[model samples]
Structure formats: structure tokens, C-alpha cells
Target: MVEAAAPAASVVETVAETEPPATASAPAVVASPAPSAPAPVARPAAVEKPVKPKPEARLYRSRTLGQWIKRVVLLAVGAIAAAAILILAARGVTTLPGVPEFLERYPGEYHLPATAEPGFPWWAQWTHFLNFFLIVLIIRSGYQVRTQQKPPAFWTPKRGGKKISINLWLHQSLDILWLANGLIFVVLLFASGHWMRIVPTSWEVFPNALSALLQYMTLDWPVENGWVNYNSLQQLMYFLVVFIAAPLAAITGVRMSEFWPKNAKTLNRIYPVEAARALHFPTMLFFVLFILIHVFLVFSTGALRNLNHMFGGTDVVNWVGFWLFAAAIAITAAAWYAARPIVLAPIAKLFGQVSSR
Candidate 1:
């Protein structure tokens, strides 16, 4: 029994020696990665404001009302003073050696037969009004054109060569109308036997006209018998206005027009443009003078009667002629004021391109 127990103990000891022994483990220690910076936030752009445009400038600013009034008053005073001075001087001059004899020798004559002729006819009245209207417009526009630095528009024909200013175009147009009217008046005057009233039939008219001038200068106004026969002075003046000034104005205007060939050196030399320009201005002045004197005489002699004779075709004094004359004057005033670039540009555009600077 002792030997079997010893063998069992020996087998247990051998198994223990062959097997590995176990041991205790510590907790693992690991560090985490650092946090990265937050991403940058984006900003919006700044806003901007808009800008405005500037206005265009003008060439010449017009004079004020006060300025014009002052000028007119000064002009009237100066004119009166000058005329008085001249007459006084002339009186003193007449006392000198040969002046008295010369004046006496040239002192004119006056003769008028008794006749009550029909005054201005209806056609004559209308034409006269038209002439006045056109002349006023022409003068006003001409002054504007002369003063203008830049043309508001230009006219280029389909068959184009040189371009013309809108104002010049208007001037030419008015001239054409005036010429046509004058032609018609001439025809009618001759056909209706009215030419005899203006045309000088006798050499004595010259002396008669000179006498009338002397009478006028002396302020002893001769009797006016226009219903039957115009004074020799009146006849001469009418003849000059109708035949001489009218044709001269037309000729000069044409010479300075675009229709005049610039290349025609020979023609230009014979009838120079400079000469035309000079004559044209003087002719316009003459017309203006005639109009002023004519108006003064008519009003001074007899307002209603003269107006009736020219406008109403009657010798009787009435308000009809005055009213018509007033209306005509009003229309002329309106036209004169309305002839600015703003009003004329559109009309000018009908013919060609109208561009403003």
C-alpha cells in the first residue's frame, strides 16, 4: 500500500513541473489628439450709390425786361435831341452865302385834281397784311441768324452739295413767298390800272417830290389826297420800294443763298457776295424806316380814316380796320416770340436732320 501511494505522488509532481505559471496585468494609458481651430466666417461686400448727369450750357443769355426798357427810353430821348440840334444847325447854315438861293430854287410844286377814287381793294388789303407779317418775321429771324454762333439744324437735299443752316433755310423760304406775292401784286396792279398811281408819268414829278420833302422838313405838312392821287413824293417812294428795293433785296438774297454757285468765280467777281451783303442790310434798314414813317403819317393824319382806307376798303371812319390791324399785329407778335429753336427745330426736321449742339 505504501509503494502505490508513492507512485501517485511522483506522477502529480511531474505534471506541475511541465505547466506555465499565471501573473496579474496593469490598465492601459493612451493620450487623445488635440482639437483643431474653428473655420473663419465669410463677410458680405459694401454697397455703392448712383450719380446724376449735368445740364448743357447756352451761347448768349437774353437781356432782362428792365434793360430793354431803359435802352428804348434812352434811344428815344437821344433821337429827339439830335433832330432838334440838326434843325437848329440847318437854320444857321441857311443864313450862310449860297444856301438860301439853292433852297429857293429847288423848292418843289404841288398839284392834285379833284377825284374820289376807290381806296385799297380787298385783295390789296390782304396782301398788304401778308407783306407786313412776312417782313416782320424775316427781320426778326435775320437778326437771330446773324447773332447765332451755332446752327440748330442743317438742310441737306437729296441732290446734296453744301448744307445750309435752318435759319437760312427759313429766310430763303420767306424770300420766295415774298417774291411770289410781289409778282402777284405787280400783275394785279397793272391789270387793275393801279400802276398809274405809283409810276411817274411826267418829268414834273421830280420837282414835286423835292417840294414835298421841303414842306415835310419845315413841318408844314402838305395836303394828302391819297384816295384820288398820291403826292409826287409818295408816288416816287412807292415806285422805289416796289421796283428798286424789292428787286435789289431779291438779287442780293439770291447771291448769298446756297443756290448761288460758289465755284462760279467769274460771276461772283462780277457781282460780289460782299457787295450783296452790304446792300442787303441797307435795303432792310430802308424798309424799316419807310414802315416807321408811313405808320406815323397814317396815324397822325387820321387813324380811323387811314386804317379804313388801307384795311376796310372804305373812306368812312370805323373800328373794323383798327380791330383787324390789332389782330394782325397780335399774330405777328406771337409769331415773333414763337420763332425759337424749340419751336423751329421740329419744323426744320421735316426737311432734314435737325440736331442741337
Candidate 2:
């Protein structure tokens, strides 16, 4: 037993000798740091694009030439339709009760007074021509004076009371001529016993005038015998134009003119310039209408004979009066064209000092 114990103890002693010895404190431990997170990337900030501004809208829409043409066509068609309707309506009116009888009884005219003279005199023809020339110039200058924004030339009188526009000067000058011509025409008319033809003698004129109007409207015009005696409608129109309209025009014109007495406060109050202005334009419009109607009637009803009565002082239908009328129209047109500042300034300088300012 001893031998076996001795062998086991020797083996333990050898293993104990081969084994490493432990110290009083264990060796200090060394730990490695953990891996850090990756640095954040810095990208360029997003760039903003500029926005475009919108355009402003127009006030009035532009129209094509075609649109204007369409409008003009519509107006012309409308006028034609209206005329057709009026003619149809007038024809229909003739069929009404008592209308036909009334038209037949009157026959559009009444007998002239015993003192009335037949046919136009040579003086009447001359006066008519003078009136036409003066009136044309008056209307042209008057319109220019009214509508001109800037005067081309101004006139200062030799005595120099006030500065007046060239157009106004022309208008005033023409007015004087017209007044003189009118006065002469009036004197001649009475002296020649022609006033009895135009002045109404009886109340039969009213019915005759109505009958004449109806006849004209129905396109069945009455017989025109202006040389022997004017129709009642014609007589009334002539009287109104010569008496009522002429006097009214003259009074209103005088009130508006520089010749009026500015110091006469009472007269000015009684006949205000405003009233004169109001009446003057309407009177001009009336004259325009009368002239247009008269010219149209002259051309439509016996053009040659009427032209001869006025222009040739005879009732013969010939080209002599027509040629003379054409020449008169040419002369009038030349006068109109020559009424500009360029031509008028020279004439104006003869009487007054002309200036642009």
C-alpha cells in the first residue's frame, strides 16, 4: 500500500511543479473603444426658380374690318326696310274712310288772291342766286367757328375792340351780306306783288296742305304749277321761311353777335345769349332741312322747267338753265375750297390785322 501511495504522490508533485503560480491581484484589464457613427453629409440647399408675371388685359376689344362692313350693311338694309314699310303703310292709309274724298276735294291747292302775280321776275332770280351764295358761305364759316378746337388765324379789327377768330370774322361778314340780300329780297317781293302768292288768303290752305302731304307720301304727287301759283303746302312753307324763320334767325343772330349792345342789361336779360344760342342752331337745322327738301323736289318734279324758272327766268325745258346751275355749283364749290385760312388771311388783312396766336 505504501508503494502505491508513494508512486501517486510523485505524479502529483510533478504536475504541481509544471503548473503556473497566481499573484495577489489579478492583471489590469485593457478594453478597446466602440466604433463611432459616420459623419453626416452636407448637400447644397435646394435652389428656387423665379416665377413669370402675367400680362394685363386690354380695355376695348379690337374689331376687324369685316365687322365694320357687316354693321354698315345692316344699317343700309334697315333703312331700305323702313322706307318700304312707310310706303306700304301710306298706300294702306289711302283706303280709309273719307280720306279719298278729302284728297279729291282739296286737290292740293287753293286759288291765289287777285293781286297775286304769275311767274318769277328777273330780280327774283338774281336775289335767289345771291341768297344761295351768301347762305352757303355763312353755313360753312359758322360750322367752322363752332367746331374748330384751334383757330388757324385770328383777326383783330383796325379799331381793335376784340380779337376774333378768322372763321368767326368770315361768319359775321357773310351774315351781313345775307341780311342785306334778305332785305332787298323782301322789298322786291312786296314791290312786285309776289307776297300775295305766298301769304295765305283763306282757311282752305290747311286741308289742301294735308292733301298735298298725303299725295307726296303715297308717291302720287300733285300737279306742280309753281309758275302760275304755288300749292297750299308750298305757300305755307314759303311764308314760314320768309316771315317766321327769317326774322327769328335774324333776331337770334343779332343777339349772339358782337354788334349787340353789351351794356343794355335789361335787353340782354329779356333776350339772353343762351336763348339765342339755343334758337340759332335749331334754326340752322330747319334751314338745312328746308333746303334739302326743296332741292330734292326741284330735281324730282320737272327738273328742267323748274331750273329754267329760277335760273333762266323762263319756263322752257332747255339745257341752258342746267348748264348755268352746274356753273353756279362749280363756283360755289370753288368758293368753299378757297375759304381756308391761306386764301382768307389775305382778304382779312385788308380789313384787319391777322395773327396765328
Per-residue lDDT, model 2, residue 98, is: 88
User: In model 1, where do residues sit more than 4 Å from their true spots?
Assistant: 1-75, 85-117
lDDT of 2 at 172: 91
lDDT of 1 at 123: 76
Tens digit per residue, CA lDDT, model 2, 18-60? 9876566987557889899999999999999887787554432
Q: Could you say which candidate leads in lDDT?
A: 2
Point out where model 2 deviates above 4 Å. Answer: 1-78
Instruction: Give the TM-score (vs. native) of candidate 2.
Output: 0.79
Pairs clashing in candidate 2?
none
Candidate 2, residue 337: how far the Cα is off, in Å: 0.6
Residues 171-205, model 1: lDDT tens digits:
88788888888888899888887777788777878
| TM-score computed on alpha carbons, candidate 1 | 0.72
lDDT for every model? 0.78, 0.88
Clash total of candidate 1 = 1
